[model samples]
Target: MDEQPGLSEQYRRVSAWPLFIALGLPIAEIGVLFGLVPIAIGGLLLFVGSIAGIVQESGYVERPWNLLAGLGGALVVLGAALALSQLPGFSPGAVLAALGSNGLVVRGVSIVVAGVIALGVGGAARFVEQEPI
Candidate 1:
């Protein structure tokens, strides 16, 4: 007869998924940036992968509040990015218009900033007390 895994073993297995997702997102994004994959396909993969990871990690498939918080975080990041693009000396439209532009650098910096923000949100989410239905 096969023995069942202990609680700690099960917890360890479950906890590893988020780390895989955190590492995978940057790799997927880099592949898109490097033209290794089509942008639409890469974006679709990332979107689906991210949502699945969020649902699995947060256990929020049946709990809408966590999903709402995640969506709100994404919107905040998007709004900040748009505002930054309009600031003096950082217009993305102008950056792309110039020949041999620093668009890659801008993109890299934004990715790093977004990653940091995501980590912050994830860390904070852990501290929130969830009430059972």
Candidate 2:
């Protein structure tokens, strides 16, 4: 039997990125709704963060949930159109118009808060030795 101290820290750091996305997803979605220029980039980040969170050992924390939420948001903003485009050969600019914007301050704030909390939890988790408690 063996335990690795670095494992928890690694997971915590990896997970933090997802929380950042979750925080940003709302803003990105809003941008999509507003027809802004940065929406696509924001949406891209959401997708990347979600995919990463889904695959990585982020542990059960805000980041993992955030990733899932971000993915859901991406779908809400443009999933159906993409599917329709494949079927009838139709396209809408909504797919490319959902991303970061000046109004994303709210999302940025949430992401920072979630990140701080997750870091604390992950840090605390690391300090707790893997043993019966």
TM-scores of the candidates are: 0.33, 0.32
Write one digit per residue (lDDT tens) for candidate 1, span 76-125. Answer: 46534644554456555664453134444444344434444454455456
lDDT of 2 by residue, 36-93 (tens): 5255445545544555465555444533444444444544345343334334333335
Q: Number of clashes in every candidate structure? A: 0, 4
lDDT computed for candidate 2: 0.45
User: Lowest summed lDDT over 10 consecutive residues: which window, candidate 2?
Assistant: 94-103
- Lowest-scoring 10 consecutive residues by lDDT in candidate 1? 35-44
Q: After superposition, how far is residue 109 of candidate 1 from its true place, in Å?
A: 10
TM-score of 1: 0.33
lDDT of 2 at 54: 52
In candidate 2 the C-alpha lDDT for residue 114 amounts to: 36
Superposition error at 45 for model 1 (Å): 5.6
Could you tell me which residue pairs clash in candidate 2? 38-99, 39-98, 39-99, 40-98
